[model samples]
Target: MNKRIDVKEAVLEANRLILHTEDSLSEIKGSMNAKGQMLVDSDQLAFIYLLETDEDFIYAGLPHTIWSKLKEALDKSLPVLLKINDSEVELVQIIDELQYLIDNIKGNANYGEEMETKVTEVFS
Candidate 1:
């Protein structure tokens, strides 16, 4: 049976993904030449599913803002171009935005703790 996704679990899972991605990026960075571009090696749709959740499982695609960014990059081609200033797209920037989304979800999960505190205040 499909288990309902707990918000806290989803946030934690996202954090795990972020950490894993960071490590992978770091390793890839080490193996690449300085002049070579570091293209993103991720499945966009799978990532989108990790970010977006439903009652049972995380669904396909991310929130609109993030999705739009991914789409813009994909439109040009996958493994998004890394750019500086106003030149082109930046891979690191995209990763940063993804981390931000994960952090945002973690914040949402923290709402449970806040609610618990309020409940104590009301009951005690």
Candidate 2:
């Protein structure tokens, strides 16, 4: 049915977005760790907003554990910006996002596997 196809497409897109966000967070963390801090300009903030506001992403049905962790991280990071080293920096958001990715990467036995499994379960 068309509805099922739409759901499948949404799920796939959501998964892609989630993976992209995870990867971006890792890159940001690495940059910050290497440079002691990094600038977060409007483009980066817009990317975060897109992820948060995207309808497919919102309805992705991510597992509660993962969803809660992401929500908490975003909540901590999104509202605060600090001027550091002559740059407008999202220090709190970067730190929170970094910590969330670190915890998920370290804690999971198979980091991305759960997401795949959840998606499969949903489509099954």
Candidate 3:
């Protein structure tokens, strides 16, 4: 029998799909600004699920061929949603945060620095 999913996990699981589409996430952040899109402050860390609403979709930047395959695999993986600005996604669910993962991992997220540089360049 399928176990009942915890309410919070269910929501985060849906958000992790955004991770599978990091390429799309990167596309949304790195390339041109779409009518309704936000940038993920990368070049530092994979720290944001810029999608703010149910209407928002994470754009995978990988080529059609790559994304096609990745889509299927990602759909099968556990989902987690980490918001770019406010929302918090547990690193364990998405992946090991090397900085946070290691006992001696650097404590610098540079969230503000990255926001000022890459993400802010677009959203700002």
Candidate 4:
């Protein structure tokens, strides 16, 4: 009984964490779009993260316009896409590592690395 109770509590905690992370990540993607806009004509991002759900294709984290753009691409019979985003906890660790690499790079401060891995995971 005690073991079962502990397991259930852990599950709840996990769900809570997941929700919080998603919210934070959405914020980051939104922020990046906004900042990029300051430099150029930035378009909202489209995120595709693989998930273990029955439908298997989860699509969310898109702003209204971007999401609208994709709607035309989807056939009427397709499964609904769930938008997941913003994990501040995860973003901090990855961003910190990237920043560390940048700071360590000699002379040129324009060093750039693909944030794709995390991006995939972010949408994932």
Per-residue accuracy of model 3 over 39-71 as CA lDDT, tens digit each: 233443223322222334433122222222223
**Poorest lDDT segment (10 consecutive residues) of candidate 4:** 1-10
- Residues 25-89 of candidate 1: C-alpha lDDT, one tens digit per residue: 21112122112211211222123322211222221223222434444343444343322122222
TM-score per prediction, in order, is 0.20, 0.19, 0.18, 0.17
Steric clash pairs (candidate 2):
77-93
Q: Which 10-residue span in candidate 1 carries the lowest summed lDDT? A: 3-12
After TM-score superposition, what is the CA distance of residue 54 in candidate 4 from its true location, in Å?
2.2
Q: State in Å the error of residue 114, model 3.
A: 3.6
Worst 10 residues of 2 by lDDT: 1-10
23-114 per-residue lDDT for model 2 (tens digits): 12211221221112222112111112111111222211122333333444444443323221333323233445444444444434453555
Residue 7 CA error for candidate 2 (Å)?
33
User: lDDT by residue for model 4 over 37-78, one digit each (tens)?
Assistant: 101011322232222223222222332223222232232222
How does model 4 score by TM-score?
A: 0.17
Candidate 1 lDDT for residue 76: 41
In model 4, state the lDDT of residue 52: 27
Q: What lDDT would each prediction earn against the true structure? A: 0.28, 0.28, 0.29, 0.24
CA displacement after TM-score superposition, residue 4 of candidate 4 (Å)? 33
